[model samples]
Target: MVTTKRNKEFCQKVRLKSTQVFIVAGTCLITVLVTLLCIGFMTRYEVDNEVANVADVDYWKDKVASSQKIWYDKGIDELNEALRTPRGPIYPKNLRIFLIQGVDGRDLAAYRFSGKDLSNGNTNFVWDKFPHFARLKNTCSQQFPCPISSVAKSLWTGIPLDKIPEAQPDCGNLVNETETPFSVLRQAQLAGLLTGFVTTQRFTGSTGAALGNTNSNYECDERMPLGSLKSGCQDIARQLITGETGKSLNVIIGGGRQMLSSLVPKSISDPVDELLCESNDGRNLLKEWRNQKLKESKVKPIKFELVQRADELESLNASNFDFLFGVMANGDLSGNSNAPSLKLMVEKSLQVLKKKNQGYLLIVEQFIQSGMNKRKELQLLNETLTNLKREEDTLTLVLLTNAIYPKPILDMSEETETINQLSETFNEAEFQIQETLYQMPSESLLFAIGPKSSIFHGVQKETFIAHAVSHVLSKSSPKT
Candidate 1:
């Protein structure tokens, strides 16, 4: 009787163990099945639907510009209305957005990182490879051939280029700026954020027009040439220096020494007009600005500092100032001697902007020329991205390769060295036009990373950026 009971108990124990083993095996099988299903779904979604080699120029231009032609026929007002209404902001993380633009549109064919070595060199190739580019394999996307004027307007105003006259051919300038994305920053500022504009050239043409009416609290760019202030759309500089705008800039840095009276080199014959065909204004804008800051310092908590070198900028005691304006270059830093690099300008801008305890909007740019300038700007941006500690908190938009530069004579001999050399001189002070009409098909590349940057994924409308930026800029801190 005892042996029979022990055998029966042992059989029960084996059966229970077998049941547990079956359950564990079934669970493992389900987990594997679910994971495979997910992988399949992700693989299908991530499949590159729109990628091809630019082997033929005619086909490529025809395909990309086809949509713009349809838009071009649409009345200018119709385009304006479309741009006025930017797409909804889909990204709302607590973030910062940096708008880095290539003033001239870029060509996609010339920027590929294929053919072994992925490096863009000073020696330009007819098809230069920009290895520094983070191939948009996952999320980064681009739009082609966005014109500079329309691009500038849409970027700041949230209007699309397809919806507006790119620029007035007669005026060679932007149409108007009745509105801007700065409205989006109103909420952000109440929460302690700052806004800034820094570029290598004078805020002239489209740049000046875009910034003309902004009420943001920070702005900077190369000073308008002495001749340009009258018509160069440089009134914003005067307004910042005099605190005449609705919102006073906290920091201003750029180059326009000729306009500063004392900084003009005496050797250049008619120094002002030699730089351009404009300028007779005798106002020392910078001195006037410093004087105003000094007067304001006595009555309020106002603190403002100005410097003219990268080292000086790096050494700034940013904590002491309510505003810091550093004009580190005399004018257009591109190929200029000892000019503060765009990267340094950006670094210092961010450093000072963060002190406001509010988020910031930073617009940085290289002169709209292609080749070495564009390549260097892109390389700097990549470095900046690599070093970012709080990428999640920042939105960086790098716009490259628009077809907006002045057309130059090309060698067209299939010689890499000749093409590269020509590219360096593409933006020569004295340039010749190869084409009568300087219009470009909408075909350059765009890149964005951070909170709302992905809102513009596919072929992004020019105005989409403004809307996305406004969405983040207008974000109030989350309620705890």
Candidate 2:
């Protein structure tokens, strides 16, 4: 009996020890798992809070939806389909179009000095020049509205009072005749490729003046004889399309309706109508262009059609004729803020230009820098570039502001963070500032994505663009 009791007690003690050991092991395992889970949740919370701080997720979601709406509403997908394929060549048998945005020079130079690869870095240099803040109020005095001459003096000459270069007498004795794109256009016309100038700004704004070479001193002055009046600019527009120059412009679409109307209308005309069409001399600029294009061309009398509505643009036949001038709005086609989108303009222009077997040159200008409209304008431009890339042989050039404003930097930072978050679960390293800072120079960016695009990666001046364009077009020249 004594032996049996001892054995039983020993067995009981062994079982108790084993149970304690098992309990300790199980407790340790549960504690470890719980600790790991807590750590994971804390990490996730930190990440979420940080992301929320950097970006307004809800706002961007809404913005993306809005952008998508705009894209769909304008038939952007259809336009992209059309531009993706190459239209048979126009002249030299090769076609190239230049899309330029006139940002100021200093801003362009700054970005040029900054390295291109820094775009991915945290520096946000490009966005710094023109900070995408709230819109600016019209601050210029009514008596001294901001003129292109004043802006050009600050941008080009760097002196408000300094005289701009005068047009050479050999180039038809035009004033303010600096070496400009107009000279290049004249050369193009001489080469017989059906040159055309299109812009959203008035037909005589800074950009318009550059293309038509109307007057140097009066870049924005629409006055006739001197400005948009009976003088050289109007003459150039008329001659290019209709006059003895014989180089009939295939396209001349823009807003200068006032320049086109006669000073005095028929007796039935309203006083306001007469005033809108009034000029120093009694002449109509729009009528002159219509008449000239409608007139038989010496080489090939091109049929001319003027479209005033978006519906008109959609209904037009693509293979109609050699010359087409589409003017959608009065002064400066409505900007993206108030006008039909750039994608609409680009698709329409392509449709019209595609008629030529001798490849055509189309210039699409978005005046984004004009008062209170930069953000909307640039957004539309970005969309245009993104969509345009769908087409082959289409080289798109985006010209930025001459200087980078500090305001856009904050938004850029926000954008960078958002992209990073979407790309990964968690990124701890702060973005490098030096690399980003390097891209802050105002130098212009020539973002080219087409044949020979590699050549445009480095720092280049504006004049180089014309040369590059000419060279590309020359490649398609008929074998002599």
lDDT of 1 by residue, 1-480 (tens): 999999999999999999999999999999999999998876566455422222211223366577665444443433343233123434533444344444333333344243556443222321122121221110101223324444455555654545544322232254445333443333354445565667666543345346444332112223334333334344444444443322355555565554343345432222232352122356676677778778877888676787866778877777566677766544455534666766677677666676533556556655545565555555565565455554446666665544243332233212233345675546655534332113322334555555555455666555555666666665635334
**CA shift at 52, candidate 1, in angstroms?**
28
* Lowest summed lDDT window (length 10), candidate 1: 132-141
* TM, every model: 0.55, 0.52
lDDT by residue for model 2 (1-480), tens: 999999999999999999999999999999999999998888689677552322222223355676566545445434443334234333234344434454544433343333567433323232222211111111111112234343322222222222345433233555333443244444456555555666665555555545554433332223323333433344333333333322355665665444444342322221222222233445555666666555556545556677755667667774575666665554455422234456766666666666434555666665644354444445555566556534444444444543323323322343344346543523333454433443333334445544454455455433456666666656643333
Candidate closest to the true structure, highest lDDT: 1
For candidate 1, the lDDT comes to: 0.50
Q: What is the C-alpha lDDT of each candidate?
A: 0.50, 0.47
RMSD after Cα superposition, model 2: 20.6
- Which residues of candidate 2, in runs, are more than 4 Å off? 1-164, 167-182, 219-247, 262-278, 297-301, 335-339, 370-373, 389-391, 403-441
Clashes per candidate, residues 3 or more apart or on different chains: 24, 54
